[model samples]
Target: MSSYYEDSVTLVAAKEILASLVESWALFRLLCLSQNLWAQEGCFPIPIISATPGSVIPWNESVKILCWGTPESYLYQLEILRNSTFEVVEKKLGFQEKAEFLISHMNTNTAGRYQCQYRKEYKLSEHSKTLELVVTDIMNQDYTMENLIRMGMAGLVLVVLLAIVIGNWHSHKVPNKEDWPDFPELSRSKHKCQTGPLDKALRDTRALCGKAYCKPGNKKTLPS
Candidate 1:
């Protein structure tokens, strides 16, 4: 009777051990399956990114950077390249697999290469393609060389105008009598002015009388 009882106890113990081993194997298989599923879910596709109002923005203006990812994504991150390394600048919760980051009062500090990423649970998706942001304020800034050139041109124009005005003034001025060229009629008038009254009367009588009347050997009537 003792021997039969010992056999029964030993067989019962053996069955219990086999049951425990089967349960452990089943649990290990289930754990492996769950890990595979988690890994598959974590492997997400790369996200897409774009900027609104164009990637080129004016200083003090605003821009909207949009990122899109898989529907399962719950969080989105925006990163910028600074000093050759990427740093997260903003984050947003995903909605419909999309996220928007509004950057206001944009300046030189805000302009650079940017990227976006999305996270689903504990795994993050691959980063999106780089987008370049450009900020311009050329109209407002003063360039030394450009300003100097403009000033030099303006001064040159003023000098030219002054020279023209002076030339016109000099041209319009009345010339002195001494500056005028001498003519036969002017010389004769000057000679007349220098002559005496008796010479002037003799010249008038010769002018009124004919040359034949004035001749020593001829006689003719002179006009009254």
Candidate 2:
């Protein structure tokens, strides 16, 4: 006849609450942008995709970054930085068919906001997305529901908490860039991502081109 059962249930509830916060924070606190564009105009000349490290990526875990672009014949270049200073922590040069990258052996140095740099034809293409990776000391924290509720204000707190339990239940991201499963196990691939903005743009461009040339009425007129 121990009171331990009450503590166990409380722990479960607490985890549910805080997990929700982590998710909502990830969804709303982010702004996705592409860096590939015309140099002088800074115009996004091509469609591309990528993954920015998110807060959940665990220590020593690997995250895959993917991206593609217009002028499908061109190559793709990828780079990673752990901070806003744009410090180069990892680099891959002259990659013609690289769409994704697996970040492994992550440590403290790898923990931070991650940005994916896209390059095409020596010109910068659109950036994929940006996300932050924060390592947690799960071993030291109790992190039950009550403790988590103490972390946020009442504003949208319930909704955010719900989102944490329901994320990935309603839909999946279009492969542009995101971390999944759990941040603590980031070194592994939780799922596969096949599409992103780059993939969508490539598909749209091809579809449009097909309509212009293959459709019935859009024929080119000869100069009379």
Candidate 3:
């Protein structure tokens, strides 16, 4: 009876120890899972970097470099490299989730590669994909060429219209000789009958006979 009591006590103690070990293992696993969850939540995600009005900017114009995809209350850092070189031309810091770095009066020196990263407290995210900035005066040149083409076309149209108007005026001013009637010609004998020396002499002889009237029978018919 004494040996059975001792064996029972030993069994109970062993069971209790085993239970404690199992509980400890489970607690350890739970602690590890919680730690992992915290680590994941603390880590920062990669940000997106881009330029407003496209990557190709115009000279002496303003451009906006945007950094997005970050959580609120995070800080952002924008960095630039000229001509893809290791040298950094500019760096800017921001506090908003969506940050903007404005380059006013951009010039040749402003053209280069740009990248951005976000940070939450001491944790920092990986740098975003590089964006290229190309500054040029080609836009102005294209505008000038377009204006010249428009002016030239307008001048050509004006010349064509003026030619049409002038042609119409000239055509209307000239009379069509073919539409006029032909005048009849008079013969020489017909002209002489109308105004000749014989006609004039007959008119004078009739006038003299009327005035003579055998005046007082004084030999009025003398000189032939």
lDDT of all the models against the reference?
0.90, 0.57, 0.79
> What tens digits encode model 1's per-residue C-alpha lDDT throughout 92-158?
8745588999999888999999999998867788899999999989687668999899999999999
State the lDDT at 91 in candidate 1. Answer: 89
Scanning candidate 2 in windows of ten residues, the lowest lDDT window is 31-40
Ranking by lDDT: 1, 3, 2
The segments of candidate 2 whose C-alpha lies over 4 angstroms from its true place after superposition are 1-55, 71-84, 93-98, 141-224
**Candidate 3: C-alpha RMSD after superposition:** 12.4
| Per-residue alpha-carbon lDDT of candidate 2 for residues 1-224, written as tens digits (9 for 90 to 100) | 35898899899999999999988877655522222222433544443444556446555667665655443324444444633465544455554445555667566766666555545546665555655566655555466876667755565788788898688665754543354344464333443254678878888777766654646786764324
121-202: candidate 3 lDDT, tens digit per residue: 7666778899988888865556877889999999999999999999999888856799667878899988877877888988
User: Cα RMSD for candidate 2?
Assistant: 52.3
Poorest 10 consecutive residues of model 1 by lDDT?
215-224
Highest TM-score, which number? 3
Worst 10-residue stretch by lDDT in candidate 3? 83-92
